[model samples]
Target: MTERESDVVIIGAGIAGLTAAYRIKKLFPKCSVLVLEAKDRVGGRTYTVDLTAANGTDKWDLGGQWVCRHQHHILWLLEELGIETYKQWLDGKKLMQIGGHRIKSHNSNLPPLPLLSLLDLGRALDKIENMVKQVPRDDPRLSKRANEWDNMTLEALRDQVSYTHATRDTFDIAIAMISGIRPREISALHFLHYSSMAGSFENLFEADNGGAQEWKVKGGLQQVSELLTDKIGKENVILSEPVKSIDQTEETSVLVTSETGQNYRCKYVINASPLHCSVAMDYKPSIPLTRQSLANRSPVGHLFKFIITYKKAFWRENGFSGEILGNGGAPVIPGCDSGPIQLIYDSVTGYGNPALVGFYANAWQWRLVDLEVRKASVLKHLTEFLGEEAANPIHFIDKDWTIEPFNGGCPVNTATTSALSFFFDGIRTPHDRVHWAGTESATQWNGYLSGAVQSGMRAADEVLTRLTPEIKLDGLLQELDNKFPEPSSSSVRGAVVMVAGSAMVAGLCMFMYWYLT
Candidate 1:
């Protein structure tokens, strides 16, 4: 077995790992750094491939594809790498399949529903936004209702706040698209924290005007990581080396062993993979139970993303925006068999090739199904919503994050019900010389590419302080601060008003009950 020594060792060569290596090398040139990745390629969750063989000349991103102006870290990194981005196509009307039968087209961001259902959805969203403001980004458990919120499932909250079936179904669809799981599986507190970190809950799904899906990189999102690897130097990164164990028993250094028996000795170690991936490794003396429990409880999102290339943009020609969402028809209740597809968007390639990108509703149900069967279902659904032209596509490609051994799944891992309240401390707290650097550990944009960059910078700074005591991290610290800004006064006042309004309503109800009795 080969042995090597470095100032620091980073596990996983994803965006976070590559960013940490780049920051360390740029700031402290003298410090030796090494990056180890289990996969043969880089980019972690971001995977871009050329579609030339499928009658397309442009590259397609099969994973983690969207970004917006508000995601500062990802935008900043793109600027640093000289990468360009284009706005998503949002000029035409959008279509929604209601009650798994009727198709409706609308120009607004919201789907067409009954007036009462819309009002209920608006009220529920406002209440959720207010509650989200009450949760702290640093430690959610510190909030007054943390335990209460964490103990309750988001599904239960939905049922309580929403008055109509449409409202409840809408919330379920949003949850499925954002988290790849049903509302009942996630914690209310965890969902609130996730939304708070993303700047607001609405920003999580909006496609236009600075929303999360507002833009796409010119070449592909993966280019950012590839460029970062170039800057870090290829020799410093070793691929196909899955770390089997980490031992920090020695006072001066930590030892990391790979599946191939190769050992790496370093002063500090940064784990940049997903939470579950870290849990797979055997650690000397074992990590804290809180951390273990957190990893054990938190599960990766099951997302099956696919891209279909067509000769023409038929939806746009039909005055349709190429965006489609289906929730098993109008009263859109949540069920595993709702449909094969959940959401889709116009994904014209960088070279101007027409394409449609989307995800499946229930990944587990379709993960093992025949590929042709899945494709047939997707085309039939698209044709029913868009037009006969949707049935024909020049090329098709897809990636199931569930089948990936390295990542387990894509988008992000979520905190299960009660997991955050009981094990929040273990999410980011370092143990011995080991540091965490995944999107899950970030304070802002927690599951996006921006979060990955922010976490990498934070973890690298943690190592720098110990490696070089005199190193000035003023710039790095400033960037980190921008990511975890304090809540606005206006938001706090809104929360207060919401609380007072609830109290007044309860008192009036009690008074009416007493008089009637």
Candidate 2:
């Protein structure tokens, strides 16, 4: 087999890996860098499509469509890339559905409420504000507190709020759908962290270009990844080459055969793959016990995005702004004008004619994906909230994260109130020549596209620091291999058994909670 070399080798050409490669080349032009991607394409989870229309417009955006004003990394990148964004339209009547009843209001000032329930929600927001203020953005304690909250289910929080059955159902379903995790499975702390980052519910609802402040790239989001790839050159960025094993030896550092039986030798390796993917890949010198353990425990978030094309933004014609929120229930709680995904937005500026993007989370989606009878079910739900006309969308597309191979699931950070000190402190730390960078490893915007870029940039910085004259990369690689040897077959079996047992226990606990609670 042919052999190759580079100053640094990064696995996975997702946003994180691509960003790191670009930044490293910029910082140290003399250093040789190589990026190996499993897929033939770049942009891991960011996919954008251009659908030519009959009216000379195109429908698009398959992934990563929105950016908030507060998301500095993405905003800055767009500015640097010379991408323009338009304000999200928020002018007109908003719609809300609850218990199968649709409430239409032109007033944007206050949330419709049964006064008392609204007051309770206000009190809850106040408490959340206090919680956010107390948690520092960069504190080490953030992970610990987040874990603690993870242990307490969302149901527990609902209980604390003393919500009525209807109110509890509405809030729980809405929050679960937004979070993409079952209310009972998600930690309250993680929920709080999201609130803190978003600023408030109102802030989250207020879109920049439209609802969710979503923007379509004038060309496509793919342009961002393409720009970075152009800077790195085609030779250095290898595609359709997935790294199967990373063998670190005292004498030589080798990347074992990929699916195509090819190997690349490198002095240092940066693992930008997601935590679960990292676990699946073989490591000759082996990863740290802490990192392995965390990988086994990390929770995967479920997020689904669907795009529908209509002849026009018909809801607008009927005096509706196309934002809707609802409980998990079909007629009422599942639709929202702007809250629980009853939120439909205008996708005409960058893409084609009238298009609507729908997001679903938690059990609502779980049930939706499983139904043998899908189209009718979806139509029923849409018709209830979006009128009978919405039932016949011209183009329909959906992305199921669970079914994706490269990505086991949608992006999610450490659970709130769960012990993540080890994950952030030990697992994410650079070990000699090996470094970790992904959305999960980021401190800010932990589970977003912004976080992935930030983590990549930070990992590149760390690698540059280690490559300084004061530290010897070759010597460090040797020490790493000597200290961490590959496990024997018997040991591998034992480890697998241990992981299986832990998974069983965790599953049992989840089942019991679901059954009894």
Candidate 3:
């Protein structure tokens, strides 16, 4: 094994790992830092690809892309790193396809379905908004209803709600695009907890000036990750080194071994990879059962983040905004089985490159379709919405995270229906000297860039505290990882499960009480 020593070793050279290394190095210049990445690239979930158009070649993010002013951590980092931002274009008419009808709207609001449908949407939103505040994100198991909600998927509850067909379709699209999983695939509490973390469900879907879609980095988001690698010194960030195991057998330090026989010994480790990838690494003493079960059961969402470049912003010239929402997309929620794409957005930059970004629902059927067939179907679908002018793209590029080797899926990974309730606390807790930091472990914007940065800083603080031994980092640590209930003893895996279809009426009724006051 090629052996080396460093102050800290981070696995996964994505934003989280890179940010942690950058922050720690900035604070303690003398400290040695090493980052190991499994993929051939640096940005974990954030990937920037180049496409040539009529005028010139432009860049688009094939992974996690958008950032809102509300995402404070990433926004602050952009400013510190000297990255600029541009507002997303939403000035023209936007289209929403539902069933056989097409609805047009000039704003980010839900489509103008029938009055009954609109009412259904409003009620569902209000009820969900109220319930969001009550569920604690750090440890959802502590919530009285956690055990009950985890037992069933969101689809089970959808049946009970008196939503108009249109409203239901809209909900499915929004949810699937955000988490990359069908509502029926994830627990209701998982949905509620995510909504709570983002402050509201609307914040997850809106493209308004203050919504999650507000602004994007001037260059591709991958530039941010690349800069971190540059700042930490490129030699220290090793790519294509899939970690084989981590052994902290001795008391003084921990040893990390890669599949290529590269060995690293460091005082502490910041495991910034997703839970799915982290669990694959062999740990000597083994991670807690609670964490192990969560990793084993967790599902990485599948999504196609694709972009089609055009000679010009053709939609804009035709008086149509480039935004397209597939509300009436398919009978199936998110309509992956029924349609080619669930959502489309304007990918035009300040530099005048014209393009349309599309996200296809990760349906099992979609994956089964041949790549050429998928591409042809997408182009045909665009023709129906944007006219024959959209029939051909100047350049076409798409990435399905499911196919990526090192990185399991895109956007973010999610907890299974019953996993979060049982293993929530262990998500960010340090196991001996091995610390965890990833978007999934973040507090504010879990699954977003903001969350990745927040978790990275939290892990850095943890390592710094242990090395210093004089200062109390608990306060900062607590703020980063929200205070959740800890297991009373080492017998970590408890027999706690959420009841299926058990608490909808009761939870909503409780919310009604808050609504009345």
Candidate 4:
């Protein structure tokens, strides 16, 4: 092995890749591991920006912000890292504005406006709970049931409930907005999966401090990436190196060439890139047809996020909870505030001064992106809902995930149920020296931060189990070097270096064995 070589070369430095590197190092200390990131920075979609410059605002999350208490993986990691999270505030009255009318509502009661809207919301929740119970966690029966549900659209389900025209326009559209897909376009199974992950509509609605409140790092989510990097060492990580092609030759050895022409040889390669982004990489012995098909069919959800800083919490003064729900049309912004973004908090809750983070979802946002007119439109909507005084936000920042080169979309949605199932199975099956470890590839918490970590750990463990011989030999060499450190001339340094190099090679072999076996 040479200086340019590593036992395993991981592509992407997002949470998934970083977690994989950390797990590999912890499990195989003797092995050499390298993490290559195409971007200048880590944290793929998890970003926090300072909005103080714009409006004397505090911290703002641009991507992947909220975490539910039931989301065990992310919560556990935060606990382990000693990261603090504040509950989002959602007390007071919530506005249910639709068809140009503002309807006030509470968590325990129906909105004061329309009976149809109330029934739609109630029926939607009941159906969601029933659907969630229908799908047992990790049940092999899921695939079969998914197949059945895949044949039906969300619109069809709504029709079964016999919702009125206005109710369908408001409530049905709202579901689509929350899921980032039109109700008619998304499969019913996907909705069930989302509901199951969320627990229930009531649980989803209730935030601890405010509304199913969001937690942020005192610094930023990027701190998690930094912590992982510190443990892996700078030498083992490479940035701005995009992998162009991967060649798996005889004996399970992989030759990876970057876009810059630098080549790296490794026993195993973990591709933690997003599904859509992976399509750009060339594989010598092409990936399975199923995987390729999945990649091609990958769904890119609507992309929209913004932060508005006002003179004060103006909505609060008006007896509003600082929360607004709407469909995207004449009334409510469909899928508005379904998550923590639906609930506004004092910008100072995490790390800034004063600002509110707003989130949007679904076809309405997709149409906005398609038209390239989100910023101005968002401003107009905010102004209308919060009044003209609250219209001119001091600071406004938005992230268009659709335009991201590596992440062709924001979070994966339910529309691509079949594609996701295929891709998940295909990638996890392993092929030669190639391994897959990404948030989308996880068996649990498939689209969350914790799933990414779990996938990384699984990939690392697989490698550790495969290359036992090399690891054992490297361990012995390391012991010898440590015991004979006093050698001055023709010293153990040379031997130690050799052992270090061999350990890396062994790590590669282990990865190959794990991937192949």
Candidate 5:
């Protein structure tokens, strides 16, 4: 029943939307902006909650929390916001569990697997890495084997490349942790494209040295959005206002109606929500079937994240790195029960709250269980991996993003078979006046915090061009470009790493052959 006007309107007050608003306001201080969020919060996937420990209450991030040096945009944003970051605790022995309950501890990066399994894993990873290098960063469909790779699922590719059960299961676990989807659900081309976005498959999996999980923000990752909202002014952001429809009947302005009958009229609109949420809205002229199909094909990843705060860092005390990677009970495919966990990492708070975090990926069966049952299973698994000390925790918190109304799932959306190749244009192409700005629309670090920031900047740039055709690229936008240039091609880096890895694998194979003889 109420109406308002603004120069620009942004849907979803997550990092992407807020970043767009921030960028616009910074560039043109006179332009009015409004950000509407369905949930009663600012940060979308980046959630930071407090957990009570013996010492005091400390905060823990249950959502996207990791950052690396190579992720220039997010690192630059952290520096701009005066936020500090600490390296992820990764010293000491690490544990790996495979083939049910069989656990092994190793101090080095290599998992404690047999020589043959290790060699098999090395060859399989190298082969996949080579395939990933061929996928273009801007569009996966342009890859040489896009049609062939897109038609097959990642599970198919895994089966074809890996010779050992251990190698296959390890690859599955990594995929689950990275994408939050079963291997059978995502396209091989999509997986390769994701790897290319991170610069390489190794960067996606490695925890240090230009890897995705190298560092953690000191306070919480959510502070990025919070600080952006602060800079954008709290009055400019409206929460609990889910957009119902967008009508661009007027040639010069967009009319966005909320579920509560509140209307916002703006010159341009930027949709920064997940693909699923954007599909829920009713468009005036109707979105193209291709774009709608893109949303239907790209399903949000199902992920159940849990964090446990203990009285002390017992694993570290015992000289364990608090990092655990396991495939649960047994390897699994779609249409079958799966083990409850994939990976765990040291989640100690910045203020020294002893804690650990983990994820239940590709295990939809666990989602049906109650919190108590889920908590018990996770604690039991932790006890087996860490020690009896993990059984008792000061506080335990878990988030099943599947059930969240606004966000159907957490992390990111995975392209179904052939979706990336057939519907690639629907992702970033502007529909009339509505532009896209989610992490999924990014090119460099898609599905990551850095990606969200980059997409927002891109969207802001697009709108600036449309609004003032004569506007020049000077000021903050130009400064950012000069200070943090886009990263170099990952193919070059991946080739170097792959060569060294292949050499090591060949040497190991020869050594094992000689030893057996």
Candidate 6:
């Protein structure tokens, strides 16, 4: 194997890995950085698609495209990169499919549902909002109700609350949208952690002014990685170099081998890949059992993101914002055998191109139907939701994350049932000169691109201190978490009061959504 040496070597050129490399090269100009990636391109989950039908300028963000106003680190990075942001369109009414009936509503807070079901949904949201505060982002395992919540799935919670079919469908869609998995697949504790990481479920879903899907990059989200790569210098990053193994027994971790017969003898190795990918590499002296267990349990999300380009914003002309969601069919809930369309958003690009972006379905639904048949069914359903105009799109492209090479899925990796309590903490624990950085290891916005940036910055600090012992900057990374301090008892009570007061102002439909996700 061809051997080389560098001060620091980072594996995987995703946002996390690239960010770390960029920070190192920027902060310590003398230190050399070698970024080895499995894929030829950067921006792991944040990939932008080009659909110029035979030749017209049209692009779509098929991956992690939206950023929340609350994600300050990402916003800061955008500003530094000279990337501009634009707000999502919400000028018209939204469409919701309930019990096979499609209803359009102008309200942003509440979905159209019966009063009985709305009350039940309200109670569920309140419970989630209050309970999620108990889950600390740093270490959810230590929470008082960790065990009970871990053992039970969000599905069990749905049953426990005895929600109506409408409420159940809403819960199912929300969980699937967040985790990219069915509600039955994710544990209650895991769901609560997601809520806590985002401050609350309301911030997680809302898009009006300050929500997660609040803004879009002018060019595309992938531009962030492209700009970072440009700053780091093309020569520093080596693509198509999938790392095969890491030997860290020595003080310097003197050897790291790639699948293509390249060897790196570096002082420190920053493993910037997700735990799932990291554990795949052969490690000398073997990693801890907890690390292996966490890797085994951490599953990437299974989702298919599609962008259907239209000649114009047809739905907007019809007074529709192009937002579509539901539990199933409502009281008649649609099962896996029924259809695959889960959520659809009005994704009109910054260039004033008319398009609709949608999440087709989870892995389970994808398996139920063939691709061509699924496409046809989606168009038929879109026709039902919009009109005949939906059937004739300029071009439509679908990205199936489940089948993507070098990446089994999209969004970010998630902790499986019981894994968080037993083994998740060990995921970021370094082995000698080897360290970790990925969205999965982030305490804030764990599954988003912003989380990846945070983890990358944190890992850079870690390596900096290790490389220059005299620097002694131990708590630099902790500063990011300081802004998100734990909520005090009084604050929690005040929040509850505020939510109660909102319910008193608006109906239960609006109150529950304001209180929760």
* Weakest ten-residue segment in model 2 by summed lDDT: 484-493
**Can you give the lDDT of residue 127 in candidate 1?**
80
In model 5, state the lDDT of residue 207.
91
Query: What are the Cα lDDT values of the candidates?
Result: 0.83, 0.62, 0.78, 0.61, 0.85, 0.78
Residue 137 C-alpha lDDT in model 6: 81
Model 2 segments more than 4 A misplaced: 52-59, 99-106, 140-150, 165-167, 194-216, 251-257, 331-343, 361-373, 413-417, 421-423, 469-517
Error of 4 at 127 (Å): 2.7
Kindly list the per-residue Cα lDDT of model 5 for residues 1-517, writing each as its tens digit.
7699999999989999999998888888888999999999889999998789757898889888999987877777788889999999999899988765588998766766666677677778778878888988888888889999999999999999988888887888888888888889999999999988887887888798787899999889898999999999999999999999999999999999999999999999999999878879999888877678899999998778888898999999999999999877553433436556678999887888899988874557777777787787778777878889989999988888888769989789989998987788888998899999999998878999988988888899999889877776455544443453333444423444555578788999999999999
Question: Can you write out model 2's per-residue Cα lDDT over 83-172, one digit (the tens) per residue?
Answer: 776555455676655554555453453345554554455555445445555454444355445655556766686577646554565566
> Per-residue lDDT for 513 in model 5?
100
TM-score winner between candidates 2 and 5: 5
The per-prediction CA RMSD against the true structure, in angstroms, equals 6.0, 13.7, 8.8, 18.1, 3.6, 5.4
Q: How far is 343's C-alpha from truth in model 5 (Å)?
A: 1.1
| Tens-digit lDDT track of model 1 for 1-517 | 7689999999989999999998998889999999999999999999998774234478889988888877888777888899989999988888876553577787767667665666676678778878888888778888899999999899988887888887787788788888887888888999999988876777777786566799999989888888998999999999999999999889889999999999999999999999889878999969988888998988888889989988877788888888887674422123345567778999887678889999887777766677887787788778878878989888777789988869878788888888998888888899889999999998888999988998898899999998999998768546645754443333322433455466568889999999999
Q: Sort the predicted structures by lDDT, highest score first.
A: 5, 1, 3, 6, 2, 4
Separately for all candidates shown, the number of backbone clashes (residues 3 or more apart, or on different chains) is 6, 31, 5, 17, 0, 5
- Which residue pairs come into collision in candidate 3? 97-328, 98-328, 99-328, 147-498, 148-499
Best lDDT among the predictions, by candidate number: 5
TM-score (all chains, Cα) for each model: 0.91, 0.79, 0.88, 0.78, 0.92, 0.90
Predicted structure 4, TM vs. truth: 0.78
Q: Candidate 4 — what's its lDDT?
A: 0.61
Model 6 RMSD vs true structure: 5.4
Candidate 5 lDDT at 479 equals: 49
Candidate 5 residue 141 Cα shift, in angstroms, is: 1.8
Q: Which stretches of candidate 3 lie over 4 Å from their true place?
A: 101-108, 327-336, 471-517
- Candidates sorted on TM-score, descending: 5, 1, 6, 3, 2, 4
User: Which of the two candidates, 1 or 2, achieves a greater lDDT against the reference?
Assistant: 1
TM-score of 2: 0.79
